[model samples]
Target: MRATLIYGLGDVRVEDVPDPVIESPTDAVIRVVLSCICGGDLHSYHSWTDSNPKRMGHEVIGVVEDTGADVRRLKKGDLVLAPFTYQDGTCSFCRAGHTTSCLHGGYWSRFDGGQGEAVRIPLADTSLFRLPVGGDSELLPSLLTLADVYGTGFHAAVKGGVTEGSRVTVIGDGAVGLLAVLSAQQLGAEQIILMGRHCARTDLGRTFGATDVVAERGAEGVTRVRELTDGLGTEIVLEAVGHMPAYEQAIGVARSDGTIARVGVPQYEQAPVGNASLFGRNITLTGGVAHVAGYVERLMPAILDGTVNPGLVFDRTIGLDEMAAGYRAMDARESLKVLLRP
Candidate 1:
C-alpha cells in the first residue's frame, strides 16, 4: 500500500508501506475511499524538526472490508466516516459524549498516520458512522467534511454560544474557518464577519454565509470586526486558525461577556493568555480538541439532504499518488482544500 509520510518540515512523500490488518477483536479494516489534506496536517508537517516518518491523515471515508468479531454496528460493505480520534463507546467519557477525550482512546498524536490507502479502525462501533447505502455522491464531500473540518467549525460556533440573531466573527479563513462561516449562518447568526486577506477564501466565506469580509491585516482586522458589531464586538467568535495571531484576533474581537471558542490546533507549546485582559473584558472562552461525535451525527442528515453543502470549500482534488502535490498546494495556499481519491 502507498501511504503519505512526513519525513520532516517541508518534506512529505508517498512510500510503499505494509497494509494494515485487523489487530483487535473490535477492529475493522477500511479501504480508503476518499481522503484529503488538512490545514492541521500541514502545520505538523511544517513544524516538526526530526525526520520521523509517520502516517499523515485523520479524516477519511471508506468502505468496511473486514471487521473484528465483536464489531456489531458495522459490517463489510458499509461506508463510514470516522473522527480522527478513535474511541470505545463504552468508555465513561464516550458515554458522556466526549468521544475525542475518551479515556480508552489514544491521544491523536500517538497514532502512526491516517493518510494512507487503508487503515485499521479500532473500536469500530464507537468511531464509525455509516452513511446511507445509496447516499448522494454529491454529498460525500460534505459528509467527509463532517469527519473533521466542518465538525471542528461547527464545534467552534456551538462552543462559542452562537444562536439565533447572535453577532458572530470567524477568526480564520481556512477550510474550517469557511465552514465556521456556514455553520454560523445555518445556526441563525444575524451578522457574520470573516477576517482574512485571501480574496478567494473570503469570497468563499461570503458564499458560505459570511455577511461581511474584512481584508485588513492583523490589528486592523480586529477593528473591522468591532466596527461590524457597532463597537460592542461580536457575541460569539470562532477561532479556527490554530496559530498565535489568530488566537489573539479571536480574543480581541470578542465582546465583554461574549464567548470565544478556540478550535484551532495550537502550533506553539506555550501560548500566553493575559489574565488581566481576559479579566477586564470578562469574556467567556471555551474550546479544545472538538467533540465531534454528536455534531457529526446531527450534521449528517443536513448534508445528505443538501441543507448544508460544506463541499464548496474543496477547491482541488487529486489521486493517492499525487499526495505530495496536494500538500504543496495547501502549503502555498493555492488550494482551499484538497480531496484525494484512492
Candidate 2:
C-alpha cells in the first residue's frame, strides 16, 4: 500500500507502506475511496521539524474491507464517513456531544493517516458513521466533507450562537471559512460578512451567504467590518484563520456582547487573552476542535438532498501519488481544497 508521509518542512511524499490491519476487537479496516488535504495538515507540513516521518491526512470516506470481532455497527462493504479524530462514542464527553474530547479518542493520523489506500480504525462502532446508502454514491465528495470541514464549520457557527436575523462575520476565506459562511446561512444569519482578500474565495463566500466581503486586513479590516455593522461590530464572529492577526481581527470586529467562535488551528502557542481585550467588552470566546462525529448525522440529510454542497471546496482532485502537488497547490492558494482519490 502507498501512503502520504510528511518528512519535514515543505516535504510531502507518497511511498509504499505496510497495509493496516484490525488490531482491536472494536477496530475496522477501510479501503479509502476518497480523502482530502486539510488546512490543518499544512501546519504540520510546514512546521514539523521532527526527524521521524508522520502519516498524513484525517478526512476520509471509505468502504469497510474488514471488521474486528466486536464491531457491530459496521461490516464489510459498508461505506462510511471517518471523522478527522477517532473517538469512542461511549465516553462521557462523547455522550455529552463533545466527541473531540473523548477520553479514549485521538486523531486518526496517530493510527494510520486517512490519506492512504486503506486505514485501520480503532473503536469502529463508535468512530465511523455508515452512510445511508453505499457504493459510489454521487454524494461521495459532499459526504467526505462531513468527516471534518463542514462539521467543523457548523461547530463554529453553533458555538458563536448564530440565529435567525443575526449579524455574523467570518474570518478567513479558506475552505473551512467558506463552509462557515454556508453554515451561518443554514443557521439563518440575516447578515453575513466575510473578511477575505482573495477575490475568488470572497466570491464563493458571497455565494455561500456572505452579504459583504471585506478585503482589508488588521485595523483596516476591523474598520471595514464596523462600518458595515453600524460601528458596533457584528453580533457573532467566526474566527476560522489560525493566525494571530486573524484572531485579533475577530476580536476587533466583535460587538461588546458578541461571541467569537475560533475553529482555526492556532499557530501560536500563546494568545493574549486578558481583561483589556475580552472582559472590557464582555465578549465570550469559545470553540476548539469540532466534535465532527456528533455533527455528521445531523448534517448528512442536507448534503444528501443537495441543500448544502460544501464539497465545492474541493477545487482539485488528484490521485494518491500526487499528494505533494496537492499540498503545494493548497499552500500557494491556487486551490481552495484538494481531494485525493486512492
Candidate 3:
C-alpha cells in the first residue's frame, strides 16, 4: 500500500508501505476510500525537523476490510468515517463529551494514517461511525467534514455560546474559520462578521453566513470590526487563526465580558492572557482539539438532508500519487482544502 510521509518542511513523499492488520480485539482494518489534508497537518508539515519521516493525514471515510473478534458493530463491507482520533467509548472522558481525551484514545496519524490505502483502527466499534449514505453518494464530501473541520467549527461556536440573535465575529477564513461562520449561522446568530484577507474565501464565508467581511489586518482590522458594531465589538469572537496576531485580534474585537473560542491548532505556546488581554475585560477563553467523533451523530443529519454543504471547502482533489502536489497547493494557500482519493 502507498502512503504519505513527510520528511521535513515542504517534503512530502508517497511510498509503498506494509499493509495494516488488526492487532487488538477492539481493532478493525479498513481500506481507505476518501481522505484529506487538514489545517492541523500543516503545523507539522511546516516545522517537522526530525530525522524520521512522520505519517500524515487524519480525516477518513473508508470501507471496513476486516475486524477483530471483539469488534461486533462493524462488518467487512460496512462504510464508516473515522474521526481524527480513536476513542474507547466507555471511558470517563468519552462520557463527558471529551472524546478526544478518552483514556484509551489517540489520533489516527500516529500510524497507518488515512492518506494510505488501508488503516488499522483501534477501538473500532466506538471510534468508527457507520454512514447511512453509500460510498458513491454526492454527500460523501459533506459527510467527510464530520470527521474534522465542520465539527471543529461547531465546537468553536458552541464553546463561544452562540445562540439566537447573538452577535459574532469569526477570525481567519480557513476551512475551520469559514465553517465557524456557518455554525454561528446555524445556531441562529443575527450577525456574523468574517475576518479574512482573501476575496475568494471570504466570499464563500458570506455564502456560509457571514453578514459582513473584514479584509483588513492588525489594528486596522480591529477598527473595522469595532466600527461595524457601534464601537462595542462582537459579543462572541471565534478565533480560528491560532497566531499571536489573531489572538490579539480576538481580544481587539471582543466586547467586554465576552468569549473567545479558538479551534485553530496553535502555532505558538505563549500569548497575552493577563489583565491587559483577556482578564481585565472579563473575556472567557475556550476551545481545543475538537471532539469530532462526538459531533458526528449530531451533525450528520444536516449533511444527509442537504441542509448545509461544508464540502465546498475542498477546492481541489488528487490521487495518492499526487500527494506532494496536494500539500504544495494547501501550503501556498492556492487551495482552500485538498481531498485525497487513495
Candidate 4:
C-alpha cells in the first residue's frame, strides 16, 4: 500500500506502507476510492519540524473492505463517507453534535493516511457515514465535500450566526473560503462580501453568492469591506485563512456585536482578542474543527437532489503515485484543490 508522508516543511512523498487491518472491535478496514488535499494540510507542509515523517491526509471516501465484530452499520461493498475524525457515536460530545471532541475520537492521520491505497477506520460504525450513492456516481466529488471542506464552510456560517438577510464577509479565497460563500448563500444571507485577491477564485466566490468581491488585503481590504457595508462592516465575518493577517481582517470587517467564525486551522498561538480586537466591539469568537460526521446527513440531501454542486472547488485530480506533484501544485497555488483517485 502507498501513503503520503511529510518528512518536513514542504516535503511530501508517496511511499509504500504496510496494509491496514482491523485492530479493535470498533474498527473497519476501507479501500479508499477518492481523497483530496486540504488547506489545513498546508499548515504542516509549511512548518512541520518533527524528526520523523508523519502520515498525511484526512478527507476520504472509501468502500468497506472488512469490519470488526462490533461494527454493525457497515459491511463489505458499502461505499462510505469517512469524515476526517473517527469517534464513538455514544460519547457525550458526539451526542451534542461535537464529534471533534468525542472521548474516543481522533483524526485520521493518527494512523492511516487518506491519500493512500486503503485505511483502517477506528470507531467505524459511528464515524463513517454510508452514502446513498455508489462508487461510480458523478456526485462523488460533491459527496467528498461532506468529508471536510463543505461542512467546514457550513460550520463557519452556522457558528457565526449567518441567517436570512444577514450581511457577511468571508476572508480568503481558498476552497473553504469559496465554500463559506456558498454556505452563507444557502443560509439566505442577503449581502456576501468575499475578500480574496485571486480573480479566478474570487470569481467562483461570486458565483457561490458573493454580492461583492474585495481583492485586497490588510488595511485596504478592511476599507473595501467597510465601504461595501456603508462603512459599518458586516454582521458576520467568516475567517477562512488561518493566518494572523486574516484574523486581523476578520476583526476589521466585523460589525459591533457581530460574530467571527474562524474555520481555518490557526497557524499562530498568540492573537488579539481583547479590547483592541473583539472585546471593544462586543464581537463573539466562535468556530473550530468542523464536526463533519454530524453535518454529513444534513448537507447530503442538497447534493443528492442536485440542488447544489460544491465539488466545483476541486480543480485537479491525480493518482496515488502522483501525490508529490499534487502537493507542489497546491503549495504553489496552481491548484484550488486536488483530488486523488487511488
| TM-score of each predicted structure versus truth | 0.95, 0.98, 0.99, 0.98
Query: For residues 26-106, could you state the per-residue lDDT of candidate 4 as single tens digits?
Result: 899999999999988888898889998988889999999999999999999999989999989898898999999999899
Per-residue lDDT of candidate 3, residues 4-54 (tens digit): 999999899998888998899989999999999988888889999999999
TM-score of 4: 0.98
Clashing pairs in 3: none
Question: Which pairs clash (backbone N, Cα, C closer than 3 Å) in model 1?
Answer: 55-113, 57-114, 57-115
Model 3 misplaced stretches (Cα beyond 4 Å): none
Off by over 4 Å in 1: 107-109, 133-136
Order the numbered candidates by TM-score, best leading.
3, 4, 2, 1
Q: How many collisions per candidate?
A: 3, 0, 0, 0
Tens digit of per-residue lDDT, candidate 2, span 110-207: 86898999999888998899988766677889899998889999999999999999999999999999999999999999999999999988998988
Q: Cα deviation in Å at residue 4, candidate 2?
A: 0.3
Instruction: State the displacement of the C-alpha of residue 209, model 4, in Å, after optimal TM-score superposition.
Output: 0.9
Instruction: Let me know the TM-score candidate 1 reaches against the reference structure.
Output: 0.95
Question: Model 1: per-residue lDDT, tens digit, 50-141?
Answer: 65676788888889999999999899989998778788878788877777878888643255456778888888888889988443377788
Better of 1 and 4 by TM-score: 4
Q: For candidate 2, what is the lDDT?
A: 0.91
* Deviation from native of the Cα of residue 106 in model 3, angstroms: 1.5
Candidate 3 is scored at a TM of: 0.99
